[model samples]
Target: MGQLERATEATLARGARLVHAHPRTLASVVALSLACFGAAAYGIAQTAPDASDLPRRLVTEIVAHEDLPSQLEALAGHELQLYRSEQTRAGDGAESLLARMGLVDAEAAAFVRRDPLARKLIEGRAGKLVRAAATPAGQLEELTARYAPANADLAGTHFDRLSITRGADGRFTARIATVPLATSVRLGSGTIRSSLFAASDESGIPDAVAVQMAEAFSVDIDFHRELRRGDTFSVVYETLTADGEPITWNHAAGRMLAAEFVNKGEAYSAVWFKDESGRGGFYGLDGKSKRRAFLASPMEFSRVTSGFAMRMHPILNQWRAHKGVDYGAPSGTPVRAVAQGIVKFAGRQNGYGNVVEVEHGNGKSTLYAHLSRIDVRQGQRIDQGVRVGAVGATGWATGPHLHFEFKVHGEQVNPLAIAKSSEAIELSPAERQRFAGVAQQIRGQLDAALTVGATVAE
Candidate 1:
């Protein structure tokens, strides 16, 4: 007998009174629902048309058949040809290469070994793309090998096609032809899990493309020192193909068209562009050139072994101020000029070993020391990125490494600092409009590249 019980009873009584007051209206709602249900039930109860009463139609056509014996004879007369493709191995010879492709004709193998043009397949560099056609009976019908052009200068634009075919007289003939290479645009993206090279490899990016990415962002990020685990990159690049097959030669990798690299939380972008005068370079979307007065590193990619600081010298075994930066790399790795300049000195120094010194104007100079071989000579004018020498340990020191130093007015300073503080090339006012259009197109491609990379990573 609480107040709550009284309120509940009053609410129920009010609802009952309302229902009684609207009885006719409620009856109409119930009757309408019943009519709808009756209609649905009647539709469900209706039977389908009787199968015997349904209309039916029949149609027939004649098909000619060949006699079994004639079919068998025709199949027997047709020689089954099998096609197989493989990459040439380092030590592959005529017999071994053909055997791997399921070809067993001794005559074809003999011609490959004796013919001057045919022997080129097994010679020179390995990894050439080879395709062969053979009969079911193991007779070689034809073979074609595509590799880098014979002329080194033409490698980027052409490829050498070697064909060995069986003639009607049962003799094998070999011919070599230089064919122009085809170009295709390709997109790639990767996240830096461990290193740039590792991420690029996981994304199926070519090594050359990865190197180009590093060079593209070299001004903003020191790949060797500033690379982080979560850094990511997207790229649009050109690929050279021989007869629709991507070339495997190192020299055949085409130039990078555009790239976007996100290091840490900041993103940097670059697109390759050529001006009216045909002078080409990488520029940002804002129309600023990425090329500076000098490159951060003399080598494309290498770790800094020693910095410009006071430390125990590896050779002297005593604490001394190291004026130059030491980069650890494999022996014979190409060393490039840091900036465009004339070679002031290119010869052996007492402690520096085989060194190349280039004097940039305005009292600025750079030195590359401990080279295994010098490619440039004194008084030779070389541009930035021109190969000057190869890494070596020729001085009074340890293993193979390149010693790099930057000087301003005969005083040694940190090369990295000088490279970073150098002036950047800017685009002309006339070129900005044309560059904006190219930048817009490249931005979309880079976004697509990022999507592709994320899918691959997953």
Candidate 2:
């Protein structure tokens, strides 16, 4: 035999002898040998050279790109002609609003006024989007108005849709429908640099939302006076959408569910909650309503021309205790009633000139002086923030300004100081329990929103 054949036979003979002497040990050795042989074979295969250019096979097919049909392109052009918008003013009538919407169809206007269903589209609440599709020649073809019902679930989860379409025969059909809208909570946090609106604009929050936020906390925080440069605010509110598109911010009827404002290192929070009676109001975490008996000022936002202190009278030219605060505004500015009360007086009063006094419960009352016109009658009941008169320089003043006074038990107390002590309405025992649950849920959402805002900011 050759040398290789002789070696193989010799190795087999040695293993057979070991098996006969120690069978278990010989079996283990045989298994180990087989394992090593498999590993060596695998290593050799891995180290083998790649057959990159070994052989070549080719297969080809032709594919053609399809172009959009001309009809489809025309349809898209028509769709682009659809005019979409939101109702801007509460005083806008069907004619004005339709004209603004570029719908010059007089028949549409008549239908809106006469048909109840069509009237719903035209005369319903403002702050809703009204869409119109017109022919290339500017003739109205279709119109749609969408708004949230007062009872819409959880802020913008539903929308009431009104559709008006012109038939091919020139007849108009109107119908009302409900559409499901996607609801999402958006969080925005802003630090004031110059003004609230400015900060809101910088933070991507709408000015309307910013105004609402200020109103929500106005009882405790004077946006005009108390706002500081570094004051921060975090807001969590609702946004409604359809077909993955969000509605206009003006028409977004969602409430500010939660808000946190850190002014001068003091934190204030407001959470929206509805009691058992379905009365919804903003309350603190402890279930105290943020609504005070009076707003800090008669105006929503204005600069203080003069404070409630001794100042030289422009007309008298003598130093006297200014019983009320003066807010500088234009002459036709609408003055607001500071509190809910009967119109105690609504006319001129010597140096006070055109003035209105409203007496409230607890022997409290407010006085608004210096007016160009009076809108209330004596003994007529009025609510807070109602237009009492217009700002004018009719009183003993050099310019148009509102002189506001707060009286408690017939004695004048600085309105600013009284506003600080304005009482808050506390929820009842049962109401408090319900509010706690709602508060807890809102708290969780606020935290998540704040975290998301922080991440985006980073």
Candidate 3:
């Protein structure tokens, strides 16, 4: 056993000491042991202890994995519960899952404590799911297995890893772990002023991606409040690499040009740039940083129904820091990766629920939380303006909304105001004709669509 394992074992021993002192359980245990000996003395082996003496009905508890609980619940369980776990080591599960089912209150711990060497072998870890069941006659059962981490590095970092198991006697056990993660992510920048869905549909960017594009530029444009009748944008950015393969974006670059908001009677234009210099930042056409201390959301046009502040947490009632902005909308609303990044997290989290964290270079990161469904996975590469998940209340939320957050190093910052305009790439005179051809094709499509709509109206 390593020093770390020994330390953990010693700590658990100290906690379980009180349970060993209770006379109530000792008496029942002694009585049971005597019965075992009595039967053994008569030639019956203790290996086959009397089952009739055990309880009739049983209760089992399972944690983490969804499949095991159903299997145990299928048994004639007297009662069963599925609870979250807090274990942090490999062997923490060995006994916890079955304690209730085997009616063995810390028996696993008791045995480990009795044998210091065995305790030494208990720590160090792996992932696992745990199940605990109880019998009417008063017995607990447990079962646990080594679990594999989706991200090997996360084995000890995500603390609630769990597993389920069953004993030959039909008892169930549950084990839990205790590694929690504090996350950071990154996003790219771009702008689209055309109708939300249309822009994405035309660009081959998903609706979620369009929404993200809108959100990324919202801080500077006030998309809901500020936009023009004719606006254009240009961009360049990085994509996240997973297993050495780039699949998604981690950051982006670009400009919003000629945003002709007729009502606003203004044309908005900006050059967005990512400062590769250690100073790190986005800039507007005026060379000022539009990046606020944070980003409003990673998604675009989702509508900021909730801002960051103290509010009633949909779950775990009480005031809590709403670390991100919430965009209220419908389920399955496409959520885009705000920047080029590798998905560091793509799973359920406390309060945040279904979440994805992207890590951009330079300690800058972004987070997309409170999602109903995730389209990506841990270590997956993503591009800026790519669909990474969908908006919905998967965690502690009041309704369908995307929770967007920006973090520098580890601190949250406003995503808006991040000057996305740095420098606009111009089509070389040689490439101008080619670019114009593409532009004309788009213009032709727009004209056709408007004409058809007019005819239909008439």
Candidate 4:
């Protein structure tokens, strides 16, 4: 029994010594075993009968190649004459339009002046592209022009195209038709570097679209004072094209479907919503109207020289409460109305210069002073953002600056405070539900745009 125990102990010690002597070899063996087991298990799990029943045996056959003649027909060659296009320049009259089109026909000129339809073709239409098709001898065959009238809704109607064609009998026939456009939604994002217009140009956004975006949020934010470097914006707007080509660069000038602007770390969003009555307006995600009772500032952009406070009057040379805030701007800068009101007084007032006072209901009145020109007349009803006058230093002693004041119940108040404190309109219950769906769709588009913008930035 003792000899057997000793022999077993010796055997265990010899095995341990062998493992310690060749640890690398032992590890390799274990690794190799694991690899083999894993391979076998994978092979067993992946094994399957051939689902496609096809022959495994190989067969060979020889085939002959046959040659055939070409079946393509030769195209007849002809000279390609492209229609020439030219933009009507400033001071362009009927003679200039005809001259640019390479047409010298006296009958065509007379037709333009005599016929009503022909007169509509060139009446007051400037800076628009006009295309003409002419013969090799400079004889005008046809003239075409497509344009949208001033303030026309692009979504509801396409551009009007007027085609004046000369028949083989030498008689001119004029016809007006709608040039259809293919509508599409485009997403764009830009970061403000120097100015909004400059940044928009760099981001490939049209100037008209940028202007609309500013107007969309003009009620809450003052673009001139609030815009900062690195402020970013993303918009999902509509674009129009004709024949798969862009018809106009300002295709998105009509309406903005969705817009987002992050200014000073605050994000403002607006989505367009149209009710059953076909009335549309920009609204927030929570279904609140973006339009307020008044805009943030009378001017689109400016710098405030003096805030509402008690200070020494430059003209009076005495200390007095400056009831109105002063905004320094260039002469002839357009001044907009704060809200819908009636022009209570328009003309020169004591120490106010050429001032315009708009009286809103509920004993609220707004005063715009120091104007070189007044566009609105007394007792005239005016809407918000309407240009009332121009900036000038008229009454009060100062440079070209606008003196603006707000009053409640015949007492003067700070215009900036009232503008910021006014409540925005809200949507109805039924409209809220509809706006929710619209907002969801806009959110999806905005998300996709953010992703694309991030990728582009990277």
For this target, which candidate reaches the highest TM-score against the unseen true structure?
1
TM-score of every model versus the real structure: 0.80, 0.61, 0.36, 0.66
lDDT, candidate 2, 109-195, per-residue tens: 888788888887646466777778887666778888777654546344666778899998999999877778887678888888999
Mark the 10 consecutive residues where model 4 has the least summed lDDT.
68-77
Candidate 1's TM-score: 0.80
Residue pairs clashing, model 4: none
Which pairs clash in the backbone of model 1? none
List lDDT for all candidates, in order: 0.90, 0.80, 0.53, 0.80
Per-residue alpha-carbon lDDT of model 3 for 98-185, expressed as tens digits?
4423445455455444553333324545323333344454343433323333456553333233433455865434444433433322
| Per-residue C-alpha lDDT of model 4 across residues 1-458, encoded as one tens digit per residue | 69999999999999999999999999999999999999999999778666586558778998865433322222223444657787766676666678777777677877877887777766764655578887767667888876664446653446667788899899999987766667777888889998888887887776767877887787667765678999988888876654344455344443578888888899999998887688777887878888778766788666778778998888778999989888999999999998999999999986778999999899999999989999999999999889999999888646899999999999999886787788887887887888898899999998887676777778
State in Å the error of residue 103, model 4. 10
| CA deviation > 4 Å runs, candidate 1 | 1-81, 250-252
**CA deviation > 4 Å runs, candidate 2:** 1-185, 239-254, 312-320, 330-334, 361-363, 381-387, 390-393, 397-399
Instruction: Give candidate 4's whole-model lDDT.
Output: 0.80
